[model samples]
Target chain A: LFAATTVMADPLPSWSDTEVKSGIVAFVETVTDPASDDYVTPSDRIAVFDNDGTLWGEQPVYFQFIFAIDRLKTLAEADPSVLSSDVLTAAAAGDMETVLAGGHDALFEILNATHSGMTVDAFQQEVAQWLEDTKHPDTGLPYDEMTYQPMVELLRYLRDEGFKTYIVSGGGIHFMRVFAQEAYGIPPEQVLGTYTNTEYAMVDGEPVISKVPGIAFVDDKEGKPINIERTIGRRPIFAGGNSDGDFAMLEWTTAGKGPRFGLLVHHTDGDREYAYDRESPIGRLVDGLDKGPGLGWTIVDMKQDWQRIYTGQN
Target chain B: LFAATTVMADPLPSWSDTEVKSGIVAFVETVTDPASDDYVTPSDRIAVFDNDGTLWGEQPVYFQFIFAIDRLKTLAEADPSVLSSDVLTAAAAGDMETVLAGGHDALFEILNATHSGMTVDAFQQEVAQWLEDTKHPDTGLPYDEMTYQPMVELLRYLRDEGFKTYIVSGGGIHFMRVFAQEAYGIPPEQVLGTYTNTEYAMVDGEPVISKVPGIAFVDDKEGKPINIERTIGRRPIFAGGNSDGDFAMLEWTTAGKGPRFGLLVHHTDGDREYAYDRESPIGRLVDGLDKGPGLGWTIVDMKQDWQRIYTGQN
Candidate 1:
């Protein structure tokens, strides 16, 4: 009855006819009959997703990067010595020009100052509490509430169909581990991300886990597939991402010797969300889109397929 | 009925009462009831294992390092101008003492000379082919077949219980990718190891992947847990290792909330297999065994627990 109601209320409501029909047909055919050619045992039904712009919006600036900037400003106000005036001013104003001009070397300096020296649990709680009240500059909606509605529906649908879903992102591991569960219904353990070294120490009488700066691993581009294989131990049946960063992930998934699905979300609706690709510094979808047809990837055009952008409004 | 037949046919039938009980209980409890507290939903059931010592024996020497030494000799023999006499002699005698006297800097030189410049696919094929016939100096069995019998049983038991198994080792990722599937039933995609940078090149109009000499990541000690979290999003429900290198993985796994298992295989049987720990250059298991009980870890005493070491005539 729940499935019936979900189908009736939506009835392919926000999806383009082709996108809705193709996705539903493939999933239903795969699960409904064990005798069918498309049949997949539930154990084999695994779906992986990219966070950032794929599941949520990453316009103007990446949400995590934005969080870091805000964190910098807050710390600067408390201790002016934490960051130079130029760095603090640049971060507070959201000036990418001034911030990245220093390149990776400068970026690490800021990151180390702000992200290190805190216990992992304290950092996680800080991120969680910040996310609760933080709103996107343009939309004025809490960042978590700005997640793509259709993608959320798709996630729930896949789970109901017996697919185990995982969030594989390029954000900080402990950072993403903070809120993935409450926001995506994907538990903290199922969220993978870039990480820093964490050391165990005793603070007063209690054991505390402290974060140390420096690169641990980068989970971007080719690293995605490597991480997926390392962590999940199975090639996902379905993989979804929104940029060239995710291209290797889709490539890896489709290369598996079995039925597979790769979906790319194209940011085509400038009205609802910013639309820039190919040359964009963030969420670049060039080679992936050109190669998708050959790779048998399903491209979801956000503007055409989805009537609603974020969930809270819809 | 099938389970009963398997129990009787298992090679290590004379295991100590504690070992037999723990092994059987873990296996049975994990597989029997889908709704039982110990039952892991197939998707959530993931087991990771260390390769060098836990799977195949790493005693006397690490097999890969031996391969590297042999490659160095072959290279010097082919081109005397390429290698220094000191390096060649050390490699020929398998005297790591003289070779590593040069430290990390020298080790890299030997590795680059021996490992780089080959197409990854070609290198993988060579590794696979080598293991097919290469015998361990002590046992004369094909090096690949020298896997510990008790560990092999544990792998099969876990897999049969619906766990997706992975080989997470400090050896080369590309190197282990070649034999992991055939040896452990872990597909190449599920094998996580130390990695060297690889480059894409066009050779005679065909795309070839070639290895480049440099450390990408070393999956040892603390690096093990970090890589696990980076590549595999979830903390493993089960983990197995035979050395101090695997301690961090065991720590991270057991630290996670929920039902988790950590195992350490102690090399205590010199007659059946060379036994040394704490002082051994290979497969040291001292710190783990010392703190294992406090961490709720299961220590497998190889001498008392395993009726067999390797498979077959052993």
Candidate 2:
């Protein structure tokens, strides 16, 4: 009995002993078993994740949006002309209401200003510097520390089982790559996200690859499935998300033949973390809540499902 | 002497014992040796190869271009209307003279007609079917068997030494992916190439991702380095190519700060393989021959440096 207990210890420690936990564990076991009909080969055992709310906290606004705003603020101090538009001005001032009211158009405006027009190396350094210097407004924790403990555990557990984990986020590919390897144990090539056009040039006898302004592809909604197909070239066996933005990824993943798993992280704890679903703007969960269960997707009630939310959480 | 002979039993069997082989062997050993200052971590041991001329034969236009022309001919059997343009007619009629005179614009015309409007899955199937049914005109060998024996050996040698090998080519991603895994032992996600737009939808409760017409990105020349930064994230420690198109890829790769390596495959064997380089329209080696050596790039003279050209060749 003691040997059995030691051998079968919980791989996802932060996840409570619930169906959400059991279902994930069962799915992994079945697919990994060599003699089982559902056994997936190591190469085909790809697992994709939505980053913003699924792996980390995306409250008040998405953490990437906040990063973009802080970048604008920093740039404004160096040159006030960067706040060229009303939206940019509102964004730099940290006025979420005006920026939120402007929707994706407004977000794109500021993202274009702060994210592009520099070498990708330089932009990543800016993100790293900002992450090092700044703290989350509400939590007073560094942004990198906002990753969910159970999700990080889940990522590691899957990798331990010979599954290759990937971060399929709506966040910038370049941005998430800056911390993904450290934060989630997912390397840069495994992180897929929204990306803009880039130009490679030889200047001053040195190679330079710059992030030029212009949208190349948006990795959200239907774009998620398309991008996954484009980059991964294989349908993932497991897919996890937190919002309506991740609906299609879940749909496409579970609809594939053979044993598949879809997980939706429902933010249901106001005290421990956040409790928003139908009404939340940042990580909205409507279709995922309504249609997900019908599609055999597990909706994780964070408050009940998690023994701990973030690492070192009080 | 017996122990060393057994231990170092020439890893690259098809590569003749030339300076090229010695150079490559020394570079790999130094970087992979933990005691060497030039040692790179296993995670950073990325080696990218240009597909057509570098890893396989591309003397009679790119093999992917040949695929496009063959596919159009097959499509014409079903729908004669597919021959809607002069290039399409020339392409279908096997009139290489007219098609060659048309350049890339004409090539794009035929490609856009045959490659798009089908699911990426279906297009890959078409490529697979074509490879099965068709044989190269000059070589009288199956297209998949056209891969260079020496380069394939090199790929395996690198992988055995903990290097993650990738195919960064101007060929169609969809086209190469069908054969790359079997031909070069490189997987789909690691194969980066020219790709077009795609769309996703749910038809009859099934998810479908289809290739749409329009250039999304071209992984050629300057685009090679830019796409590398976008997809792979890490600057590759080694790169190999054969044409002016691959000049930028090798240039950017070797210019990076480290003990880097660049290789050019110059087609010099007219007996065992097609040997035209500077004068040949396909796989032209002018820039690579002219400037590659000046940049410390080792040029592999096919006649002098290869014991085998293609697998099972006479």
Candidate 3:
């Protein structure tokens, strides 16, 4: 009933009546129409999306980094040893300039210091509580409310059409899992992201998966497609992203035989959402902009294509 | 219709109606019954099983090793350089004594030599062809026909009761994925096991995941639960395995909140099937035998409990 009504009316009301929207709708219809030569089985209609810039706003910086910095500040209040190092001190203080100057090492070090040595359950709770208590510095809105309205509609429409949607992000898996279900209607299992090594133990007769200090794997660059293959075990038919980090995933997804769709969310709306692409420190878009159109990918101009940005925003 | 008929009649026909069967049935009923206090939603009804001795027979050496040895022999026959080392030569020649003398390193080396440097699609095809042609030396039955009938029935029953079944194994993931669906009704994404590092490349406008050399991760012991958490993102309500390698998976599963079920398949029928437990070179069963029952795990006596072992054998 939901699918019928949505298909009858505008399936994506937030999406403008443009080539991008039509392209997406047409591709979905062609794959799902059964009679079409490009018809794909329901089980094969897998769609993967990058979380940070594609699903939500990543301007100012990646929100997860903000989460880490804020979390470390509170943690350091109790145990100052968490901020013993100079780089740690700068990151916990929300000094992004200094943190960025120290490069990726400083950024990851800050994350690991605040992220590890806790139970998976406890860390999850921490993320949940932070999402509840915290707000985006610029938007002054809850993190969960920051998800793009049009993308959420797309996710719902795809799911209704018998597609299994997943978030393949560089964000922490445990962290994204905290609110992914409530925010985007994507379940925890379908949310794949960067993960850390965990130790399993019986503590007080209860099974606990403890988060250790170290990176198991980073789900970025080529790691995106590799992790997708390992975890999903199927090449996705549809993929969406907003940065170069997701270039390989989109490339791989669309390169498969038969009907495939790749959508690149170009953050071109400076008034509605901060739009800095090529020079942006986070979610820098380069290769995707250069090569995406040639591969028949639909590049979404956020300023023109989306009627709304946030769920209730215009 | 399948669920209704199975529920009215014997859901598992291969069993001789023992407590082992009753325990599994009762637990499944309690969780799936929506009115019951222990009722779990279908999304949370995740059931994980270890592939090798649990889903299919692993005796006369892990069947995957036989596949590797067999596959290696064929590869070496064409290109003698494929067996560049003494251990490689012995493994290719099916000299288990020499391979065992060299230990896990030799075993893994042989597997890598035959396993890596191929596309995932090609490796899957190789495994599929091998399963099609190869028969058990002792039983003279096709490899796919060696699955336990009672366990397969249990998997079907649980699935009928709204459980999502998964295979967490110590075997090669790509190899087991070849026949898991046809033989055990488990899908590729749901089959987790030892995996190798893979590189994603666009060759001639086609995306290919090449199986590169090097062990990515081994899904055994603690890795079973970790992989479960990573892939499924939920604690399984039920888990089953045959040896000590599955001890941690079962232990961690049964320790979860609310009602849970753990099953250990005790290979005790020496005449019907080769049965070596405590000191067996493969599928060792010491820790599981000692502490499983105390932790409320059901230990299936293959000789007494099962009226039939293989799908059509008694």
Candidate 4:
């Protein structure tokens, strides 16, 4: 019995027995062992991670989109004329409530000013700095540190088992590509997300990638699987996500021919993290939780399965 | 000399000697011979070919768009209600000149009805059959048979040298992905072009890909290199085309490190094929031809370099 426990002991050093045994360790062992029926080859071993809630905290609001709204407010305050003709009228009439209510197009107008014209390196530095200083209002922890510890452990465990991990999210591609490699160890090329138009130009005889304001791609909900197929060209063996936004991607990945795994991180630890599903506007995990059991998906109960919720001192 | 020529004889049996010796043979020998300075590794051997004029004839007009227009006309004639309000209005105006000038938005409305609501396989089969039956109005040969013999030989030769070939074009991705494999021997996965939105659905308990019109991507002019970088990740070592539309692609491909090859097929064989450049609306090889020597690009004079234009016997 002791040997059996040891064999299945928590692989993640920083995590508790319950967290390791139930959440990531058991899943990794079963999926990685060649002797097991669920074994997958390195080439076929692909793991996709959802960004907002699964990787970082998305509590009252999604941080990046909030940043864009804040940017719009600041720009409007500084120079009312700087806002687009439509956004200007909206701002003047206190219509910030419904400014992004026009959906993707409205969101584009907000993000265009917030993100465009910066060099790739400069944009990345700004993101890193913002992450370092910004704290989740609810958690009172740096935004980066608010990432789910159990999920981070799962990411490492998957990588250790030769899985090529990628961040497939509704976040901006260029924005996510900037910090993904350093933050998650997933390379820029592997990070696939929504993208605004970009241009390559010579500035002072040096090549610079410039961000331009135009709709290049939108990787959301149904768009998720399409973007993944268009970019990766291979079906992932394992996919981990916490929201309904990732439901289609999970379905697409698990629908593959061979052994596949889909794990939904249910935010059940309300005290430790925050718990709201289906009704929540951000990171809604309703559809995934509902369909998970019937589809053979592992629904991760954060309260029961994770000993710790955040990195650095919680 | 005879033995060398025999050994170097066109790998594509259908191609003529002038076509083989000048274009295909030179590419193969330069890229495949390890002893040669120009030799490229299998992994590094990336080749890009323009679709419209370079692979299949785009003369008279872009054939795929023409097919869409004809399909639109037939649909309108049969059931007036099938035409969108805008399309019906455009057609009822009875101006071929106005219809042609309506551009992409008008075409999209027409294609949404004609191209959508079918399985990917079914759509591909339809396109393949169309190519087999449809003949160029001027040339009076099947569209597939109207493909340039030298370009076809070059494609096979490059593939034999272990190159991963891609068709980068202004054509629709759905349209090109259909017949490119059967006609050009370039697989659907290897073809990059303009794309419309695709929706995934379960039809009779099985996954089916369906095309919905509305531009998802446009692979033309500056967009060519951006799409290549976004989709392929790897830059090409060799690129071939016959139009100013391909100028940016050739420039971008040649800008990469390592021994690069850029070839522009100049239409100068009027007796055998249409001859036009600079001022010609279709397949204009202007800037590329003028800057070929300066940019170290190889210029192929069709009349001088190709012994045969099309594979079909006239």
Top candidate (TM-score): 2
After TM-score superposition, the amount by which residue B16's alpha carbon in candidate 3 deviates from its true location, in angstroms, is 1.5
Clashing residue pairs for model 2: none
In the order shown, the candidates' Cα RMSDs to the true structure are 5.4, 1.6, 2.5, 7.5
Interface C-alpha RMSD, model 1: 5.1
Per-residue alpha-carbon lDDT of model 3 for A1-314, expressed as tens digits?
77766647678999999999999999999999989999999889999999999998786888888888888899899999878788999887777788899998997798788889899889999988898898888888888899999999999999999999999999989989998898899988899999888899878877789899888989998999999898888899999999999999999999889989999999999888988778888889998999999998989999999999997355
Better of 1 and 2 by lDDT: 2
Off by over 4 Å in 3: A1-7, A312-314, B1-7, B312-314
Per-residue accuracy of model 1 over A128-221 as CA lDDT, tens digit each: 8888978889999988888888888788777877888888888787777776776778866578777776665446744345788776667788
- The DockQ leader among the candidates is 2
Task: Output per-candidate TM-scores for chain A, rounded to 2 decimals.
Answer: 0.91, 0.97, 0.96, 0.86
Each prediction's DockQ? 0.17, 0.80, 0.76, 0.13
What tier of docking accuracy does candidate 3 attain? medium
lDDT of each: 0.76, 0.89, 0.90, 0.73
Q: Candidate 4 chain A — worst ten consecutive residues by lDDT sum? A: A14-23
Question: In CAPRI terms, where does candidate 4 land?
Answer: incorrect
Cα-based TM-score, every candidate: 0.79, 0.97, 0.96, 0.67
As for DockQ, the candidate ahead, 2 or 3, is 2
- Better structure of 2 and 4 per TM-score: 2
DockQ agreement of candidate 3 with the native complex: 0.76
Better of 1 and 4 by TM-score: 1
By summed lDDT, the worst window of 10 consecutive residues in model 1 chain B runs over B7-16
Candidate 4 lDDT over B41-129, as tens digits, reads 78668899888878877877788866676666666788877766666456544454555577666666666777766655576677777
TM-score of 3: 0.96
Q: Residue pairs in steric clash, candidate 4? A: none
